[model samples]
Target: MSLLTVKNISLAFGGPLLLDGAELTIRDGERLCLLGRNGAGKTTLMRVLNGDLPPDGGDIMRRQGLRTALVTQDVPADLEGTVFPIIASGLGEQAALLEEFHQVSRSLQSSTDPALMERLAQLQKRIEETGGWQMQQLVEQVIRHLKLEGDAAFAHLSGGVKRRVMLGRALVSDPDLLLLDEPTNHLDLETIAWLEDFLVRRDKALMFVTHDRSFLRRVATRIVELDRGRLSSWQCDYDTYVQRREEQLEAEEKQAAEFDKKLVQEEKWIRQGIKARRTRNMGRVRALRQMREERRARRERSGTADLAVQQGERSGRRVIEAEHISYAWTGQPIIRDFSTTILRGDKIGIIGPNGSGKTTLLQLLLGRLKPDEGRVKLGTNLEIAYFDQHRGQLDEDRSVQDNIAEGNDWVEINGQRKHVIGYLRDFLFPPERARSPVRTLSGGERNRLLLAKLFTRPANLLVLDEPTNDLDLETLELLEGLLVDFPGTVLLVSHDRAFLDNVVTSTLVLEGEGRVGEYVGGYEDWQRQRAEQIEDEEKKPQAAAEKVQPQRPGRDRPRKLGFKEKRELEALPARIEELEAEQATIHEQMANPDFYRDHGDEVAQLQQRLEQIARELEQGYARWEELEALEG
Candidate 1:
């Protein structure tokens, strides 16, 4: 059942071997996730499988009649067609027989040839097998799933949209094998979920490389790891992969430690025995040297992820706030009468659909975007830095060192003004790569460059937009470690499930279009709410239930309610309204230009206090509803 048997595959870009003697055996209906650090030949291996790139040394034996469609990251946006026409490319194999019929009809009119008559029947039969005119209908069904039905020009769309269109084109073809490289990179959560279900139910074999941990867990049944020029498979999800890889590494470490002890004992004994080198001693000495080399190699082969986040200055309670802001583009609203706040050291994860204006909201808080209707205000003591997908602030033509050091009067490392070369070296930038242009650096490297700049400046508040994109596994781990321990306030907008789970302190669910629903806890709590919401959606809500269902008493729950409790419950809704009104007043003040110009320092503090009040107000409302339902 092995559909692809790639034996001893070797691929190289220029000098170093990108993939050295790699081997893979993939069978039909196998779902594989390919993992490796950046520049580890993940994309290259996929190219080799899809026949876009040939291996320098190795025989690839593919089963006959095996067709493949690749949703590559580099799927050229220059596809010479409109969005509708590009999707129509999926129906390429079934060229209509109309032209053939027209030619044959003309020829038949000229001469009644028997050979021409037979050719016409064969062409008609082939077209009939391909579903005739129904191929376009199939194409429409698949492309609609991608949500690009009425798009005018594929070429003029954003990078995310074009990626979607390309994926639709590849997926609609119904190939025997599918190669998806970072397939979920540009997709929203709903689209990703749809893709996962499709992959799970598909009959075709699939192999993809993606950083989305949740997507991989749902889609992949097998894991393929490539490291140090070798391939290994794990028949488990990404979560299990992490668990098993750690366990295996621990075993290897223990074995290595035991070997080292034996080597040391032998080395010590050998040194103790000879000032005079006898012929017998010489043989023992040579054996000990070889053992030492093996031990050294083993120690070096182990991988480690390390990080050090410098302690930040004490920040005040007020962190970030946006007030009564309304923004629009092309006469359509993105954020309307929107107000939100984050407290000191708050790690908030912003979630929304791709075009629902998550990035624009981030810009509004970062002082980059101006609201048409209302002014923006920030705390006086707050220091902020942002990370986005494009890494736009980086000078594309400049070197890594130059990009990092730009505009800074002097960069101090260990209390000295660091030389440009040395600064890049500290960030793990190789010396030879110091002179390379910024544009030449890969996605992962550019992110690292941005990190270096951020840390050197060392802001007290960090606003990150899709910070997980293009970061290698090692770098991501290092970043997670730093973010966990850092004292700075963080407002993150990311599609990366694992990253949010690991680092966030709260979740901001952008539901009801662009409106914000704040939740306590982190990604775990958000997931619980989402599940509850989904269940609510599926169930028909009864009017009796809407009255308010009784739940445990506040945080001090499970107590029996008396007459006083009943009266208190009746008054709770009014109190909730009062808190909401107060929050509105604070929001209005923060939005005023006078407040920012004269009382900038007090503005952030007021917002933080307002957030605490808002949470209590929401809880009160929920409690009131619960009591009302119970009474009904």
Candidate 2:
């Protein structure tokens, strides 16, 4: 059944019509993905559907009393309290019911008066009516799935963690419709895979905007695109959507070309002959005029930007070398005894989980951070241009031109002076937009500005940290092309699987331990190798254990273990279970609103301890698996 219907939705801003009579029907259990170039009406349309924005003209018909939740892109920076309280607030009515029930229970515990008994009974009835217990269970599940620390301060978490908390809040609501904006943007590959599985098992409808191709293929059941002020739908997977959209665009272009040719021929015939104005030729003239009007009114798709990066002076064969480098934060090791020599023209990708120190390693290599133990040496004549993920260098109050020129009207590119506006045009910023403040630009535009600034410096080594964050597909493609064609050494830290696959030749992996390993391909290639390696390890261990089977088939002998090994073998499982129980207790404490409200200051400390326990639990599980293999 269709859950919502949008009819003749018309919206416009100051510059142009964003959505021209757009219409859509969102059905139940549909996993829809919205796609388009940056600055299209995708987010705007989502806001309208989520009831945050009203279209200039439209009729939105939704199921009566349908619950919907939108996980917006912007994190609530001003939101107070710990993660638990923030997410619990999304429970809406159920939260109220639970709070009232708790209050009644507290009162009843102190006084067994007749009035208290009546209030407690009413509160219990309301809690049952609203399914408060079930809602609480769902909220806990979301929090655990996302690995969010309920007691952690919402404002202190990283951008990625903040995004995860927001996602958890929306999921806990158990809404009929879920609206997600770039849900997978800041998540690691593992978290993305988990979310894909989570959404796949869900029956509720989902509509999200993301540029992650692999995620789209795995999560989207239907694909919709906002193009040329209209919405186009494809009831297919990511691969099929791409193929069909290209075919449709090709057909349209051919049809328009044919019409244009015929109209030109008719116009020539009417002009070349004096009798063309007669009654017989009137029909041909009218058709020609109609074709002209149609062509003029049609809004063609915008052209792709030309992103060209010229090669700088060649450096020595070795671009960068880390000789036994080690870095630690407060005695917690991030990188230890790691050594890698980056050669000229090498495109290496750095990947791992969120806190694996990929960005830290990049800084260490680029001379931004001094190593704690070993030396980081650069090649002769080495010039580095680093693109920081935070975009801290850009001034939001300044104009695009001012930023690019850095208080000057001209920027030197390869020893030649170029006007700032002319250089900005290369990155798709027109003359008018160049004068606008950086704050007004979209994410993609800001990314483009970063690129523009990076190129003006002329460096042989390019270091990018999460460069694909705010970039659209077109700009990503352009950046990929530029990287492929550039004659320089590149080191990148990105979470984008497809982008990494297309650009990088090798990868450096950090597993959040003090170890860094090398892989000879992109993210997918690394995953494949890792899976095969694990399989091989499992098979070898099993085969070895089978070879050491009891000498006599009829005699069953108990396996003997040394004192240390025996104690470890006996205590590991119990320890694992104890850790798990502790985690559950922490989660329960955090999920309770009353507890969180009363102990907000203790939340951060508890979260830190919880994180430590989680790490230990993971290590313990791995050790348990190894012990089991040995016992076998």
- Among these predictions, the greatest lDDT belongs to 2
Model 2: per-residue Cα lDDT over 47-160, one tens digit each: 899999998997999999888999877777687767765677789877766555545554544454555455545554565567665575566556766778766888889877
In candidate 2 the C-alpha lDDT for residue 263 amounts to 76
TM-score of each: 0.73, 0.80
Clashes of 2: 0
Model 2 is weakest, by summed lDDT over 10 consecutive residues, at: 550-559
Off by over 4 Å in 2: 97-134, 155-160, 263-285, 406-422, 539-541, 548-632
All candidates: CA RMSD (Å): 17.1, 7.5
TM-score of 2: 0.80
- Per-residue lDDT of model 1, residues 38-127, tens digit only: 667788888899999998998999999888888876658357556765766665656235335335544655554556656645654565
Q: Report lDDT per candidate.
A: 0.72, 0.80
lDDT of 1 at 361: 80
Off by over 4 Å in 1: 95-129, 132-138, 149-151, 251-312, 406-428, 512-514, 522-524, 530-541, 545-632
